[model samples]
Target chain A: MLLQQIINGLTLGATYALIALGYTMVYGIIQLINFAHGDIYMIGAFIGVAAVALFHQNFFLTLATAMLACVVLGVTIERVAYRPLRRAPRLNLLITTIGVSIFLETFMTVLKGPQPTGFPTVLENVTLRVGTLEFSSIQLVILLVSVALMVGLQFIVKYTKIGKAMRAASEDYDTASLMGININRVISFTFAIGSALAAAGGVLVGIYFNSVSPYMGVTAGLKAFVAAVLGGIGNIPGAMLGGLLLGLAEVFGVAAGFSTYKDAIAFTLLIVILLVRPTGLLGRPIQRKV
Target chain B: MEQWLSSVIDPYYQQVLMLVGIYIIAALGLNLITGLCGQLTFGHAAFLSIGAYTAAILTRDFHLPFILSLVLGGLMAALFGILLGIPVLRLTGDYLGIATLGFGEIVRVAFTNMKITGGAIGLAAIPRASNLINVTFFVILAVAAVVLLENSRFGRALKAIREDEIAAEAMGINAMWYKIQAFGIGCFLAGISGGFYAHLLQYLNPNDFGFLKSFEILNFVVLGGLGSIPGTIVGTTVLTLAPEFLRFVQEYRMMIYGLLLVLMMIFRPHGLLGGVNFRRLLRRRKQKATALSS
Candidate 1:
């Protein structure tokens, strides 16, 4: 029973890690929280559904379509909403993100009426039993895909020249810009990649849950953000650890019969973690320079 | 005369006006924290709920008088504000915002699960104690009190803290105490507004006071102009009344607000009025006109 629950937790945690990567990456590059990232995930789910249900596409095609669409949307939002506020106060930027978040949520609500739509069952649900623990094919697929994606992301960030540029930009924006890096392109590229990951997470979540709604982004986004913060706001690996821990904690909380308070658990843990270690488990403590 | 006035203006308009007044009170309190003190609060609606539930529960189950319940509600909210401030105020910028947001969510979830607070069912049939007269009286009183507070020594200390925390602390100012007090006062007014809100609606649901509501109030302060009292009033009025006027696009109104918030921040982060003190502007204009005539 415990093993089964742990598997369940891992499956849930993998999706959170995917979403958290986008958050951490965005925060790493630009100090903005990218509040709209979660909504991009929501839009990704809708796009995935559209790909399968409307166009009768396969699962990979659907995922690619959603990721591509979110990339466009993410880039546009950055250009239209955020680019102008590049030099504005951090507070203004934060508020703008909230506004953008609300805009996407409401716009989606207007497009698709406020109802939870069932995602197409593109993948078969075949459960495999290992001892007393049973694992579904969908769960296995989600876990495998997420792990592959994270590894791919790590490769892109560490091995590629663009990745080197991204690292330099994140370390110090002004200094990186001074070194002739295309700051604008790098920032846009960051948004694009982060958004694509969120979209991928969204589709996986839709398949796992079998439903998507306009308001789904709000809670999921917050939870993923909590995951990001738990791992330390701007740390990549911390986000993964935080996501898994959060997912396990939530499952255990439900297992302990606090089902209604599941949402509260992430937030409470966030507060506790923040108070105990402002810098997340994997995150290096920031040196405050006078 | 009262009967004639009632006949001329529908009670619906009165209700709208009262709601506007209640929001004005709440926004004013937020203005102090977010606007003047430069603290970013994303869970102010939590304080609103605390006050509303406190007042509603006291009046309904305990059978207390409405005014007494209202006062107690504000005090309770103030107490919670101080409690939240102690640990939370240490964090700055976005972290502080997230912590408050978490606090708000926790409060909301707690309200949803707790049996005494009516759980998901929420408190209903609250006493119809708040009306236009009392709401208006409170609005004026609250505004006057805030204006006075802004000119006082405590207000100067808060302003100093807002400008430069380290500098303010270096200059013999107890920044933490002032921040806590500012938070307490801000929540107190929010509680009072919530008291009025509960009584006005005569129904209290935890969902009604959430992060969205907090954001709405924050928008009022931002749209008006940070640190400008009159600007908050103007911002709240324009935002609240514009919706009623554009009732045709009522569904799209929130969408418009979302777009406007982004655009407003991008185009004019200082706000619509650019954080200008209107009273000072008018006096300066008058002096210029006099000098030109001479």
Candidate 2:
């Protein structure tokens, strides 16, 4: 029973990590929370549902389409809403992102009519037993896809030229620009990749839960954001670790019959972690220059 | 004249005014914290909820009078503000915002699950002791206090902190105490506003005081002009009244609000007033006209 719950927790955590990667990446580069990132995840889920229901696409096609759609949307948002305010106060940028998030949520709500739709079963649910542990095919698929994506992300960040530019830009944007790197392209690429990951996570979540809604992103986004903060807001690997830890904590909290307070657990844990280690686990301590 | 005015004004208009008055109080409080103190709080509605519930329970169960319950409710919220501020206030900027957001959610969840708060069903049939006149009186009082405080020595200390916290600390200003006091005062007003809100609506739902509502109050502060009292009042009045006039676009109201927020931040980060004194605008325009004529 414990093993089954752990597996379930890991599956849930994988999706959160995917979403958290987007948050951490954006914060890493720009220091903006990208409040609308979660909404992008929601839109991804809706797009997936539409691709399956309307176009009769298969699971892989739906995932790809959703990811593509979100990439375009994410880039557009960065270009139009956030890019102009790049030189503005951090608070202004933050508030603008909240506005962007609100717009995305309301726009989606208007289009989708605010009803939770069950994801059409594109893949059959088949349970597998391996040495006293029972798991479903969907769980395995989610795990494999998430891990593959994370690995791909790791490779790109570690080896790719664009990834190098991203690291340079994040380290010192002014210096990066002075060094003749196109800051705009780097930022846009970051949004594209981060948004794609979130989209994939959204589709996986929709499939795993078999339900999707406009507001689903709010809670998931917040939880994943907490995970990001837990591991360290701007650290990619920290976001992944935080997501998994948060997921396990929540599952254990539920298993202990504190289901009603499940949402509170993530927040409470975040508060405790913040109070204890303001930089978060795995996060480097910030040094004040002056 | 009084008879004619009373006859001319309808209950609907009164209700709208009452709501505007309530929001004005809440927004004014937020202005002190977010505007003057330079702290961005995303969970102010939590304080409002505390006050509303306290007042409702006091009146319903303890048989307290409306005024007494309202004051006590505000005090209760102020207490929570101090408590929440003690730990979280030390964190700066976005971290503070997240902590407050967490605090807000925790308060909401506690309210939702607790039996006395009536769970998610919410507490209904709250006494309808709140009205336009009393709400107006409180609004006037709050405005007076804020304006007076803003110009006073304490207010200057707050502005000094807002300008440069490190510098303010170097100047021997107790930054932590000021922050907590500002937070407490801001929450006190939110609580009082919530008291009026509950009695006026005669319903108290934990859902009403979520992050969205907090965002709405922040909108009023930002849209008006940070640290500007008149701006907050005007912002709240215009926003509250805008929905009524734009009833045609009620469904798209939030979307429009979102767009406006983005646009406002981009074009006028200082807000509509641009932190320019309104009185100076007319004079500047006149001076420009005079120069053009010359």
Candidate 3:
């Protein structure tokens, strides 16, 4: 029973970690929270539902389409909402992001009619068992895909040319520009990649839960954001760790006979972590620019 | 025609006026924090909820007088705002935004789970004490207070901080104290607004005070320009009435609202009024002409 719950916790943690990666990476590079990222995630699920219903495709194809759609959406949001305000006050950019988020959420609510729809049964029904531990095959798939994505992200950030440019731009945009790197491209690419990851996470969640809704992203996005903060806002690896820890906390919080307190526990942990180590578990302490 | 006009238009106009008055009170409080202090709080709705709930409980359960309960509710919200602000005010910019967001969410969830808050079923049918007279009176009082604060020495200090915090501190301003004072005062106004909202709606629910409502209040501030009190009032009135005016676009109301916000940011990023005080603008123009002649 304990093992089953641990597996459940880990599965939940992996989804959060994936979403957290997107939020952390964007914040790390641009120092903007990308409030619209969650809405992009929601759009991805809606697109996934449409793809499956319209194309009559298999799960993998639908997932890919959803991710691709989200990448475009993410880039568009950045170009439209954020790029202009790049030179404006930080507060203006923050407000713009909120506007974009509200726009997307309300748009979806209006279009989708504020109701949740269940995903097709193909992915939802596939379950796998290993001895006494019974688990859905989709859960296993979600875990593997999330781990792979994180590993791939780590490699890209550490080794690739674009990754190197991303790091440079994050460290200092002006310096990166001086070094002949296109700051615009790097920022756009960061948003694109983060959005793609969010889309994938959204699809997985929709499949795992067998339901999708316009407002689902609000709570999930908030939790993932909290995870990002718990791990340290601008630290990628910290976001992953924080996501997992938050997931575990929620799962065990429910398992320990306080199901209703799950969200409260997650927030309490966030406050405690922030108070103890404002920089987070794997984050570098930011000194005041002064 | 005249008899019909009195019966039909008067009640609708009265309701609209009442709503505008209540929103003005709410937006004015937000202006103190976001406009003057330069703190972007995404949790003002939470404070409003606290005030509304407090007043509701006091009136319903404790049998307190309506006016006194309303004041008490505002006080409770201000107390919570101070408590939440103490640890988090040390952080600035986006960190502060996130911390406040979390605090807002915590308040929401707590309200959802608690039995006294009516647990998502919400609190209904207390009393509809916020008629046109009461709303109008409170609105005038709030406007006067905000206008007075804007012209006072303390208000100048707030503007100085908003212009540049480090510079203000260099000029011997007590930065932390001023920020806290602004936050506490903002909460007080937010509480009053919430109290009024409760009486107006005669229904209080946790769902009504979510992040979206916070964003709605924020929309008014941003659309009005940060520090302009009159602009805040105008912005709230226009935005609130826009949907009603465009009732044909009911299905796309939110989408249009979103587009309006985006366009406003792109075109008139300083807001419609751009923080210009009507009276001050006239004076400044006169002063400029005098200087030019001199």
DockQ winner: 1
Docking quality category of candidate 3 according to DockQ thresholds: medium
Top candidate by TM-score: 1
Write one digit per residue (lDDT tens) for candidate 3, span A54-93: 6675788888898899999999988987888787656566
Model-by-model lDDT, in order? 0.88, 0.89, 0.83
State which docking tier applies to candidate 1.
Answer: medium
lDDT ranking, high to low: 2, 1, 3
Q: Summarize candidate 1's per-residue lDDT along B1-294 as a digit string, tens digits.
A: 445756877988988898889989999899889877888898889999999999988998899998899989999999999999999898777778888989999999999999988888888888888878788999999999998888889888889988888888889999889999999999999999999999989988888877778888888888788888888888888778876876789678668878878988988877776566646778989999999999
Candidate 2 collision pairs = none
**Structure candidate 1, residue pairs in collision:** A231-A238
- Writing each residue's lDDT as its tens digit, candidate 2 over A76-123 gives 999999999999877778889889988988888888778888988878
Candidate 1 ranges with C-alpha deviation above 4 Å: A54-57, A286-290, B1-5, B278-282, B285-289
Q: How many backbone clashes does every candidate have?
A: 1, 0, 0
Interface RMSD values for the candidates, listed in order?
1.5, 1.4, 2.1
Clashing residue pairs in candidate 3, if any? Answer: none
